[model samples]
Target: MKTTSIRELKHDTTAVMAMVANGESVEIRRRNVPVAVISPIPAKSPIERPNFRGRLKEIYGDALLTVTGTDLISEDRGDR
Candidate 1:
């Protein structure tokens, strides 16, 4: 890790970026205290699921639930 004043960062941004690419952290100072740190962004791991789709299909059946419109009306009770 290294520290640099804001003025130094503004003067030579290319050098600062080079340091980050080299896997070294650079701390930017405002007056005499550290204000921000710069480092290379970490890469994300690739996801691997061999049977993801099959597992989902097995969990939830491939069917849609439906009800006939007439089922909402009450059945006639006069015959009782």
Candidate 2:
């Protein structure tokens, strides 16, 4: 939790908002008494996860390769 004066909030709105954006609750104060509290809004939408396994299967078709990716890259960049 963080505390900020209303005058400070008005003067430095961007910095104050940045704190809220980074998931910190802020207590707004007037005359040294807390008047309002602000917090980051919960993410509303479902997360979109990537289909990595499907993509790999599509690219390779169940055939296991002999070489590691690192070895393949090293072979490609030989004496470079």
After superposition, the stretches of candidate 2 with alpha carbons farther than 4 Å from their true spots are: 45-80
lDDT tens readout by residue for model 1, 1-80? 89888999999999999999998899999999989999888877998759977987888679554754554443433334
CA RMSD of each candidate after superposition = 8.4, 8.3
lDDT of each: 0.84, 0.96
Q: Can you tell me which runs of candidate 1 are displaced by over 4 Å?
A: 49-80
TM-scores, one per candidate: 0.57, 0.56
Worst 10 residues of 1 by lDDT: 71-80
**Which structure among the candidates has the greatest TM-score?**
1
